[model samples]
Target: MHKHLLPLALLTVALAACQPQSQNAAPADSGKPESATAAQPSQADRAFADLSKRWLEGWLQLNPINATQVGDHRFDSEVDDLSAAGRQKALDFNKKLIAELDAIDAKQLSRENQVDALILRNQLQGDIWSTETLQSWAWDPQIYSGLAGGAIYNLMAREFAPIPERLKSATVRMGKIPELFAQMRENLDPARVPKIHAETVAKQNNGLRELIDQFITSNADKLSGDDRKKLDDAVAALRKAVAEQQTWLDKTLVPNAKGDFRIGAANYDQKLKFSLNSALSRTEIRQRAEAEMKRVREEMYGIAQTVLKDKPTAPEMPAQPTPEQQQKAIEAALELAYQEHPKRDQVVDFAKETLAQATAFTREKNLVTVPNDPVKIILMPEFQRGFSVAYCDSPGPLDKGLDTYYAISPIPDDWSDEQVESFLREYNNRMIHLLSIHEAMPGHYLEGAHSAQFPSTLRAVLRSGLFAEGWAVYTEKMMTDAGYLNGDPLFKLVQLKFYLRTISNAILDQGVHVDGWTREQAMELMTKQAFQQEREAAGKWVRAQLSSTQLPTYFVGVQEHFDTRKAVEAKLGDKFNLKAYNDKVLSYGAPPVRFVRQLMLDQPIE
Candidate 1:
């Protein structure tokens, strides 16, 4: 959860969001000094760099799983301290860092340092607030689940280190899994644990053993003598630990879980501010999302008129339709596209096809500078499947040359045929391409590679999900507009439906946490208003219940990006080059869109 130490930049889950990276591509941080050439750094700037590094190192030590994920191996043998003392240790660490950060005058720093200073401060302050105010440790079981899951997943997912070396790290973390779970049980208050979160982690608990078997047990031969013995002993202890935890989870945590899933308006608002780091408020996000939903639906209906004009069973598509009429027309068109989906087992291969299409189009259209970095379309790791359907897992900003995983969940065996059909219908052929674009290509993969080259690890590590997701969503429109898939009206229609999901996410999130919307209410927004399939809508309902504050990033980030593009286009008139504008926007790394706007417009960093 360095989305608890995975570092903020390592994992970007789109709620609904690859290409394979080039195998021969250079290392992740191979680029030369990103900003050392920028106006000679002031003394304060140098000090700020040193302080940022120290803070990062200390923070990683406390969240060791994240440390490994971020490519810092020093803490590879350690795990996070979730006990009370550990929480206090993290609290104290943030407090001291923030105090030191404030002592540096922003006016004296370079523009780069100034922006990084704000990002670091936002992170430091957010940590303190998270521990002291939000205090999810005492309530949300998902908080601990990340550390448990990441403990093994982060170690084995990549070949960043040698088999023997990484296994050794895994050995230490596995030995400590019991302690991690123990601290988890000790810290969480049963009365405050939400049933949804408890149930989610309960499903996630056994994934630890599965990870051990697949990675550690299978690779145990790499070690020898005492090392082999150590690995075996660690595995045995970890298996027993997981069994005990699973028993406790099912018998105790799930049954006794009594907390409300909704975080309410106040918690939602505070977390929203920190998560997005945008100027938009909860009310503004809703107001904007609601308005955008209407606009997008209307646009979808217009496309539907083209794609569905001669089809039998097509809904009435009037020139100026009412809400009911418009909804019908859009759904009819999407159903047509949904019929053209991949089969159950071909999803990953299909994703690769879409990635190639997207990559070629991005290069062909020159929409943005596509990075040649290596990316792979992989099956979603067992430990990571419960959170979202698909995500882009990149190396830590500090880690170099590792491949980024464009991981998608395979259809579960236990699901009914109807459930599989529902899922494929939602992620149809056209929809999967949209996902590939958003998750990779000129979306997260390209954006992340650009971000890693930005010269500042601080900026790279503390990337804004708002900007990242927003940029990904924005590209869905950009690619379609530039004639992706030969400008198929059906493709455009599905693209609009995807955008509607992004908009609905913002609305659905607040609707759940702020207005206390029920499953029916949430489903109505996703299925009826957003035109999501039953499977997608149902899964998203659980996602909304399981978490909050991150959903709106897509909406808020995209809105800001759209505004930035329009402003810059208006300013440049004939001189605006699409490729140049795109590169420059990404050149600032993945800072909030607001700051990127300021930088692009030559405004103050504030």
Candidate 2:
């Protein structure tokens, strides 16, 4: 593996822009219920709005990278203080905010404020729990790596500011790299640091150099003499800091890191609650995932049957095949699809073609209301490579009308022929189409655009991962069901294979963290049952260890979205419109799925 490439997540980067969305209505033109014009706010609404504004201001000040990512350039030159004192300051801020929230009578607030109140309250409390309980600052080195990387990249990546201004921010942040490294070393206890995390950060340590060299030093020519000199000095200092951090990572951190990666049940459950912000329990998630796996597997086998029909070398296909027969039959069908992958060099172009295709199909079918927001396919930056193969990089709520990046990771040059083939087969032509659908067309890109239209900065910033991921996963089936790709069974099979991944992720997360499953056990579930490629399964094993509750969001989110659709359809029956239903659900900014369901169904916002 290339040590310096930092792998990124394929999450539905569900961030929002400038304003607060209405609580009870869809957009005026969305064909769902909307008041002719919004009513003037009540006193309670005014107070809640003021509280939200204050919370965001303080929160953004404390998290400057987040601010920049969210398009709040006021702190573009700042970086987060992740030291012990910094964590305490954040904790105090959150406690005070939560206390103020508690003083407000939620019932008195407008439905929108009520929803934002809950989301904000959860976020504040989650911050507190994360610091006092999970305490990843002490163990996870990736936090520092990600923050330091984002600090520079977020400033320069977008054209939100002028080149010189962004470069100036980069210089200030770059100059602080040595101090940042000092805090990373001071804040971390090697004994409590997990080895995988230590090793991952050691790999990620010098990715800062890539960011500085590519985004900063490379652009120094764009600045005037004095500014350019300052940048050169900052870049030199940043390089030294990167080297020093790498040395400590390789020598002190990696060697002495002896902490357990599995957060265990107690920590897992608490973190899960905060992370999801849904009422779903771990037990409920497991039960649903197990059941859904069986149903989805049966569906995949049925498709496999169609795809493998009359094939001479096809596996034995009884109508009621045993487990072994079913596995072989599905694998055989998938191999045929895997044979159709693009060459390594063609992956990005393939993704581009697939995205355009997904977009056209989405428009043609009218499956959902397509957003007009521009989305561009780009290569994943070197510093953001390994976590997942790709991601949708949307401008934060405060940064509207900018291009949303549909970034695909180029195949690493360092992989062996076998490894590269394994990756290609896992992400074949059909799967790339599915990924494009999920990450771009009518998925994150579409949902993000919809939520970005909502008025609340609070909802935009505290956007729900469950809703975004679930909506993305849900759209995969919706498109396939609408007969995308001329109703090819191969496409349907690959889509189910992708869905199985969601199911397996939930199962793997619990199995590793709660059930104490070993690497061997996790790999079996991914490769054999989930049908993930060796390369994909191996990466997931690492991801499952690093991310605690994140794995289940895809599963739980999609399940609730499914339930929401079913309920809405049943209620509206003959009148239910897919486009209207989709638009209405997303019209409120992307809140937790349950909250979306509540507003849709007239249930208690709680």
- List lDDT for all candidates, in order: 0.81, 0.81
The segments of candidate 1 whose C-alpha lies over 4 angstroms from its true place after superposition are 1-39
Where is model 2 more than 4 Å wrong at Cα?
1-14, 17-40
Clashing residue pairs for model 1: 1-4, 2-5, 2-6, 20-375, 21-374, 21-375, 22-374, 28-401
Candidate 1 lDDT score relative to the true structure: 0.81
Candidate 2: lDDT of 305?
89
What TM-score does model 2 achieve against the real structure?
Answer: 0.94
**Distance from true position, residue 342, model 1, in Å?**
1.1
